[model samples]
Target: MVFLKVAPMKGVMRFGKKGKLSLRFVGPFEILEKIGDLAYQVALPPALSGVHNVFHVSMLRKYILNISHILNYESLDLREDLTYEESPIKILEKPDKELKKKKITLVKVLGRSHAVKVAIWEHEDEMRAK
Candidate 1:
């Protein structure tokens, strides 16, 4: 559910083990922009995959559900409020010159909340480097 007054939240998540693929979001989510069915720029975790990375079954389902739930739940303050763009079904691997410098080909999401952002960490090295 959406909070009228932004709630405190934080954390990070990585799509891979090496911390090569990632997205970060700091929340105190103040409804950035809202369209009919899509909420663009709503506060989300850091390290959100675009739509190209290969994900494991469990990881994929979890991330999709988490985003879905957040978008589906009603807002506490607003009458009818749900925020989300789309499910993370296809996580694409992007090349980060910064990460490549560290000899790391991974992405990481960092913030404050762990339980909320855990699903993003599904694609680990052992399961993905195939």
Candidate 2:
């Protein structure tokens, strides 16, 4: 099985709703056909109909079968537009740094899961304003 890695900026700009910016991947879609050595044609859902299904090999990743990686399907409230919201549940760290003459703070945010790998570092000002 294979899945696609959602480009951070693209995901946020295209599929993110206001106050939500945490969906890192979109699908485990089936591969319809192979396109040469570096591309593939995939079966995308209706919500993603506007986008082309043919993706570069670099954009796809092998899906590892793991019970823990399986999300509760019923809990996901996916919209017809393929957009969803996910807010950080906790702030794990605040690191201050002096860049040039200005002070900047980096915030480590924890998502719904406690897994440390899922924590995302964001600018303190941006995180606070949101």
Candidate 3:
């Protein structure tokens, strides 16, 4: 199995989110056959059917299995729109970030389940409005 390196073309597909948080690679796709000296055809999902299946070796990363992957398996409840929402159960911290120009007040919101935990920093004023 190998992960496909995503082509960073602007205004194209973002596997998950936009901006710097976008997905860099997708899948541990199976290699169907060797296409040439440096390329191989991969079995990509139906969602990626529009894309060419064949890829160069340099664009693929080998997947190495280990204990951590199995032990930490947690499913994200992604919606049909590919967005996942976890309501903030509590505010963990009130951190102040200082920039060269000014100071920004932030509140750290904690979202957690029995297995999965997520934290996000939000503007203190915006969070209060919400």
* Cα lDDT, all candidates: 0.33, 0.77, 0.85
Q: Model 3: which residue pairs collide?
A: none
| Cand. 3 TM to true fold | 0.52
- Runs in model 1 deviating more than 4 A are 1-88, 97-101, 107-130
| Per-residue lDDT value at 123 in model 2 | 95
**Comparing 2 and 3 on lDDT, the stronger one:** 3
Local error of candidate 2 at residue 114 (angstroms): 19
The all-Cα superposition gives candidate 3 an RMSD in Å to the true structure of: 8.0
Score every model by TM-score: 0.17, 0.44, 0.52
User: What's the ranking of the predictions by TM-score, best on top?
Assistant: 3, 2, 1
Q: Per-residue alpha-carbon lDDT of model 1 for 1-130, expressed as tens digits?
A: 1322212234444432223333332223333454444333344434533432222222211122254545433323323455333223334453344543464344332322322322233333532553
Highest-scoring model, lDDT: 3
Candidate 3 regions with alpha-carbon error over 4 angstroms: 10-13, 71-130
lDDT of 3 at 34: 95
The TM-score that candidate 1 achieves is 0.17
Worst 10 residues of 1 by lDDT: 55-64
